[model samples]
Target: MSLEIRIAAPEDAFAACTVLRRSITECCVADHKDDPAILGAWLGNKTPQTVASWFESPTNYSLVALKDGAVIGVSLLTGAGKLALCYLLPEARGLGAGKAMLAKVEETACNWGVKAVQLHSTATGEEFFASQGYVRSGHVRSPYGVDTIFFWKQLDRGAAPDTSQRKRFCNCNSA
Candidate 1:
């Protein structure tokens, strides 16, 4: 089935949290769970409230995907052009959803006049981000001893034709 992408609403907070937690547990910090406190801190000690607060922030934007009525994948990008969260349900992996979302993020960053974008990616996501043109900048260690790779991609400033072209490219899904 094809995936539908849209901005996440306030009501989608809890569902977003579930996907994030699952991503951390299954992909990012799976081995760190032996130390529960470390694990909690590693994932930012997140709860529904924390996730909701993130959604409410003006500095962040969420791109979410749904299959039927269930949320399947999501990517959160900060106003400063840092990618904050990206997770896909196990069933939703291996699809083009992640690539589409990454493209959406780049389009948004370009609109904001951001010179570049950065992210701390998990081991599993490293290859994907690299494939999307992000180059490793450094290595980051999570609170639970999880090592995250830092990557950054410079924006192709001259690529955006103008306001009209940008609007069209940014809203590619709407078209």
Candidate 2:
């Protein structure tokens, strides 16, 4: 099915929570190993109420990807250039949805007067982040024991540098 990307509203919290929980449970099992404690801790704050809180935050920029009027994915960015969340259901993987969501996040960052974005990714998501121009900056063990890869990507503003009215500070020695 074709997908649509848009700013997330408060009403979308429940659907966004569903997508986030499923993506974590099914798509992240390889990293979390189905450990209830780990998964529970990782997903503890992903309830619909928290999702609504994200929408309510003035410093947050949240987006949701929809298919056939249902939320299939969610992306969230903090005003401070942090990519807080990006999740999609199992069926949505490998279909460019994640990349699209990330692009929108970058756009939001630039609009918010930022030069780059950063995120802490799960081990399973490391390759995907790298493929999208994000570089590995660090790694750490989460409280749940899952390995996390930190990433940062430069945002392109699509404007060529203008050197028409420039200053000349270099002096050339006579040959």
Candidate 3:
């Protein structure tokens, strides 16, 4: 299926939150272990209000991927060069949405004078980030006490290949 990447709007907050909640709860069992406590803590800040605030921030570059006008993916790149959010619903995984959204974030980051971008990724997303040319900078303790990997990638003409997005669902369901 074809997907269109567009900037997120305030009204799109609920859709974004829905995508995030569904993807994390259903697909990220590896990281969360299906524990209510851990999941609650992890998703505590993922409410629609939170998404709306970020979407309305002129400084935060947030995007959503739509298929048949439905939001299937969400991504965010902060002015400080952090990839704050990136997730795709399960059915949308194999499509080119992830790579296309990531490219847009990187492009925006570079344009905003960010020389490098860093993101905290779960076990599920580690391999995906590596394939995208991000190197593991180190490890950090997640709020749930999991040791998540910190990834960093420099911006350049040849940072990541805009290769046709491959369909691989690993431990990382999303970033």
- The prediction achieving the highest TM-score against the true structure is 3
Q: Please list the residue runs of candidate 3 whose C-alpha ends up more than 4 Å from where it truly belongs after superposition.
A: 157-175
Candidate 1 ranges beyond 4 A from true positions: 29-35, 157-175
Alpha-carbon local distance difference test for all models: 0.80, 0.89, 0.90
1-175: candidate 3 lDDT, tens digit per residue: 5579999999999999999998888878898888898899888898999999999998899999999899999999998999989899988886989889999999999888788899999888888889899999899988765668999988975666555788776858776
The candidate that achieves the highest lDDT relative to the unseen native structure: 3
TM-score of each: 0.82, 0.86, 0.87
lDDT-based ranking = 3, 2, 1
> In candidate 2, what are the lDDT values of residues 1-175, reduced to their tens digit?
8788999999999999999999999999888999999998999999999999998899999999988788899999998999989999888888777888898889879888787798889988889999988999999787767999989987864766569888766756423
lDDT of 3 at 175: 64
What ordering of candidates by TM-score runs from best to worst? 3, 2, 1
* Higher-TM-score candidate of 2 and 3: 3
Candidate 1 Cα RMSD (Å): 10.3
Worst ten in a row by lDDT for model 3: 156-165
Residue-level error in angstroms, candidate 3, position 83: 0.2
Worst 10 residues of 1 by lDDT: 160-169
